[model samples]
Target: MTAVKFLSDEYLDELGDLVTPDLPEVPHVNVRLQFHATDTPEGEVDYHLVAERGVVVRAGRGLLADSDLAIRASYRDLLAFESGELHAATAFVTGQFAVTGDRAKVLDLMVVLQSGNYQRFIADLWARTTW
Candidate 1:
């Protein structure tokens, strides 16, 4: 399996546009994604995503003191999920992905997976990489 590199800034910028329009009228939540690339020799990468008031900002870090939500999954799973090739719920059920934190907040974030917009985003990204 090839290791995938996800730049926190780029990911957040894309996610911001997709999420802002659908966000509820509530304070922002800080969600940290600790990605463990299983097939890679390099260690884990922490992607910190802060979503609040219709804005999402991502920062690459080694650790976070506070994380309302944490998602643990391989790069391939993330690619499959974002590209709509895999269902997030099904992945969770199958133990391909693990999520920890406030269940409600986690569920709220998961709602985006059902929107189908992420597929288009992933397609665009894949196209760019091919060139």
Candidate 2:
């Protein structure tokens, strides 16, 4: 799979679509995702992803004021996870990634991402897009 530009707005838009509508129906749940890459043209950078109650409240290039969960990973690791080349459990256990904040919410997000339906959706999505 071709990895999308981690800092591109187009990448953010696709990811926003992937997460926002399918988040677990929990009250007052908010998630913040930070994608870090050290070798980008602009030096180390962090891209932002924010979701609240199954809705993508914001997605761009900065952090939110407050978030219930924060998931951090290298840009490559994140793409691998998304493409199913790297399992999240393995990544977390092997120190390839990190999660901070509400453990329950983090797990919920994982469930959503790992679900069969979501996997199919992602496959279909990728088939239609260059990224």
- Clashing residue pairs, candidate 2? none
Poorly placed runs, candidate 1 (over 4 Å): 1-34, 59-62, 113-121
lDDT of each: 0.52, 0.61
Candidate 1 lDDT, tens digit per residue, 31-54?
444444343223444555454432
User: Could you tally the backbone clashes for each prediction?
Assistant: 1, 0
lDDT of 2 by residue, 1-131 (tens): 54555446555556555554644564554466555544444456666656555455555665656666666677677667767799988987787877677767766566545556457756765555443
Candidate number with greatest TM-score: 2
* TM-scores of all predicted structures: 0.59, 0.63
- Model 2 root mean square deviation, Cα atoms: 4.1
CA RMSD, predictions in order: 5.5, 4.1
